[model samples]
Target: MDLDAYVAAHLAEWRRLDELSRRRRLSGPESDELVERYQQVATHLSVVRTSAPDATLVAYLSTLLARARNRATGARTGTWRGVQRFFVDRFPGALYRLRWWWVGTLAANVVVTGVMIAWLLGHPAVEQSLLSPAEVDQLVSHDFEDYYSEYAASHFAAQVWVNNAWVAALCIALGVLGLPVIWLLFQNVANLAIIGSIMIRHDHGAHFFGLILPHGLLELTAVFVAGGTGLKLFWSWVEPGELTRTQSLAREGRTAGTIALGLIAVLLVSGIIEAFVTPSPLPTWARVSIGLIAEAVFFAYVFVLGRSAFGRGQTGDLDAALLEDRVATQA
Candidate 1:
């Protein structure tokens, strides 16, 4: 048969195979066979369209590609069940082999936090240098309890939430450049130092715990996740192992994207508390309790609940098949 006819006969099969692949039910051998067939058919059809420029062939292939793309996107965002399966079941097993990423990120956070604490203890002027006069004034003059209460009531809460969300997103997105990870680490460390210094300078060292602990825990954790993601990207470039830098980066990017999404959720919660809940006229004990609870929830989601919600055993076999098929199709 001619290329056009051959392509026409297989297009329906490709669509059907794509659908089955997404359902996470295909076995490994069957998946590999389908992927091979899909790639062969797609390549031959692509060449045929390129050589003859038949409008019918072009339209058919275009529609097929578009459908495949939509299916992939839908699989990612279609429902809570799918998303949970993807994260818990599919991602962890595929990506958790990169243990160095966890180690490097933890080490970076420790170094940065320690340096910031040391600087605050030794250099009082550094705080004023880092913070603007207005920021310093606001930190000093406002009763944090009252300020937090007012912030919670105002539109400021939404703004802070959106802003922090964007920051977390940017940290992950910009990791594509590699240097942004270092910049993020330094920026966060400097901010921590400035805040620590300001509190100590005002003789509110003890009060600082009540002021920041509520939201700071989650907010800082989100920042750390972002930093880790960026470091992973950079590490791919520095140590590509068997893969090319480009390939390594792409692999790491997929995992980092997942981490970034989880962090965005954390930032949203942190922003709510920082803007509205943290600053309430609640007692110190109440604030401490709430903060501890929030921190516990965040950790539980990341380490415990997140595992159960999105574990590898749930979707690994099917996801691996689909991923292989997609890769083959692209090739």
Candidate 2:
């Protein structure tokens, strides 16, 4: 192929694309022309790469196409509207669509925790084996309660937020494996069961509920959401249905990202409650009520905002334009 001759033939179209991309405003016809030129230049770049393999020409066309893409898509990165749309539409839409996964997770964990608590209460020997009498006394009397107030409130909230975020991230990050997510969730509830059992066995059941319920309600829910979303991702590849395995996994993985990002704020709220409200001087009823309200508000957000977004055909995935350029598939 004559590289110079090919460049000569398409140089005007490439230059036109550059000019359109640089313009602040484009007319109706100009916008259509810009898209047309972008596609042509993209094809030209593909040809140059495949046939001629001209490094300099490929670099220029690549940059030109990138600029044209940004201009054509309006490049919404880091914008307030983009953030708003994420929370209002994408995040909740994902939550609503995948509600059963997380909801089932939440229920199963609750049942397992409850059974473990019961078993521990009935089998006192197990508790004794895990913790000596003195250790159990300390946990029930001081350690459990002081854990909340041991750190300064603001510092504790930030610390808890980061830790919880890491855990949730792991759930999504390791979701593809299928077993790591369950292990994480199991370890989480097992710890809860052990503590609750010891506290209740020692006649401090009221104290246990008072401290934990204040934040545990929403905190555990966030964990469950993460666990469920991870499991869903695993299932995407396992049972991809009509879509190809790659497409199903990609769709679920992207939605998992949305849930992971959204869970940061959710976990932060729980952290704040855990740090401040759990150790506050307020009555147990009031603290528990605050936690209940937070939990309620989260559900309403999922059911209302998420439902609406899903009804509008939002799938929490990137827009079609952002996902891929409209390139012609050449044989």
**Superposition TM-score, candidate 2 onto the true structure:** 0.88
What TM-score would each prediction reach against the true structure? Answer: 0.71, 0.88
Model 2, 112-203: lDDT tens per residue?
A: 99999999999999998999989988898899999999999999999999999999999999999999999999999999999999999889
Candidate 2 Cα misplacement greater than 4 A, ranges: 1-11, 23-63, 326-331
At residue 76, candidate 1 shows an lDDT of 59
Clashing pairs in 1: 88-310, 88-311, 89-310, 89-311, 89-312, 148-279, 152-276
Q: Which one wins on lDDT?
A: 2
Model 2 scores a C-alpha lDDT of: 0.91
* lDDT, model 1: 0.64
Error of 1 at 306 (Å): 4.4
Candidate 1: residue 64 lDDT (0-100):
55
Clashes of each: 7, 0
Query: Residue by residue across 95-132, what tens digits does model 1's lDDT show?
Result: 34433454466567767776777767787677767677
